[model samples]
Target: MPPYVPRPIVVDYEEACRIRDLSPKASATLSRRCLQGMIRDFHGVREGTLAKEIEKIKDKIDPVTWDSIEAVRKIGNIGAHMEKDINVIVDVEPEEAGLLIGLIESLIEDWYIARQQRAERHAAIQALAAQKEAARKAGPTQGAGAAQPNP
Candidate 1:
């Protein structure tokens, strides 16, 4: 997890990792919650349901990424919501859970890490521009070997 990521999201992601093999369902649930928190914090889209919130960002994000988010939501749904028949037990494979975790990791990189890097780059450019402007305003300086004007 990136150091810039919020503690809540990191906690959920870590918990998901801790139990991914032991309980894929629980892990998926945690991943789902983590995704929701990210959407809320990063995108500022807090709808009634995760699905609705995701829909709001469909045009904002790339199609492939949107599809991945939908996939996570659907797969996580299995663990989050109960089926009509209480007796039935639908299992989520460990591989599927791992996929969810991988998606979360990718999102953290794509969203938070990428944004921070971009901001830093922009700031650096601004600082460089400021330095150049200052130097330009100060005018050219004469070299030590250059002839000095007669007093």
Candidate 2:
């Protein structure tokens, strides 16, 4: 499949990917921030540290997804803390950072885009069903004139 594009926070995710090669730490930081934002925006997880917020939303998501999110959280924790002290060093390979970026993209799609698409599809199906029900009640439009011949 093509690259995953999250409808929300697309720029932040994209920027994280863009900076992956140059600075894995920065990329991971961005990915972590994106996850925090997603939890707050989508799940209404507004309180506590990111780890705690994840706990609040964890049960709602599947085990596998939650695991992946936690992995990103771990990487992000290291990246975020390194900024506080010069002696605190966390090593994250480029590929590891990329994985976090990938996770963020998937979360965006799974959490936001897919839900939106499902809602739209449900609305369309309901409309069609309503139309069909109306047609059935109308009883084939009696006396609307005979079938027209093709010219």
Candidate 3:
């Protein structure tokens, strides 16, 4: 939301959007929910230190995904508390609100897709490594060992 002028450096992306009547869309909501779902699926953060937990495993996430997720999170905070404009919240515009929603949706989608791709890659690597380890352990088979299959 851009129409509402901010108080100095203070920023409230959510509230700004609301004041300007640019509330988030259903797709944005769905995307945000999906991202939340991932958080839930990975770690049942039912209570404290959710950010720390996510940070602890941050390296496991793709950098782009992580960035997008963080951006959406920041914007979400602004949107959710935009109306709470006090010493705590910031102001925004309807246009800014729409942008935030779009950004949120895109980021969430990227996080989901990137995470899946990475998981698959990791699984494949593990499988290949396991196969190699097994082959090494098996060595040359019995008489085949005596024959010296390779120089």
Against the true structure, what is each candidate's TM-score? 0.91, 0.82, 0.39
User: Judged by TM-score relative to the true structure, which candidate is superior, 1 or 2?
Assistant: 1
TM-score of 3: 0.39
Each model's backbone clash number? 0, 0, 9
Would you list the C-alpha lDDT of every candidate in the order shown? 0.94, 0.82, 0.50
Give candidate 2's whole-model lDDT: 0.82
Q: List model 3 lDDT by residue over 1-151, tens digit each.
A: 2222222211332433344464443323333444454455444443343345456546876887677666545555554434553666455444555665555445434544555777789999999999989988977665654555555
Query: Any runs in candidate 1 off by more than 4 Å, and if so which?
Result: 142-151
Flag regions of model 2 displaced more than 4 Å: 1-8, 83-88, 142-151
Model 3 accuracy (lDDT, Cα): 0.50
Candidate number of the best TM-score: 1
Misplaced by over 4 Å in model 3 are: 1-22, 25-34, 42-50, 82-89, 92-151
Candidate 1, which ten residues in sequence have the lowest lDDT sum?
A: 139-148
Predicted candidate 1 versus true structure: per-residue lDDT over 61-106, tens digit per residue: 9999999999999889999999899998889988989999999999
Q: Which prediction has the highest lDDT against the true structure?
A: 1
True-structure RMSD, every candidate: 2.5, 4.8, 11.8
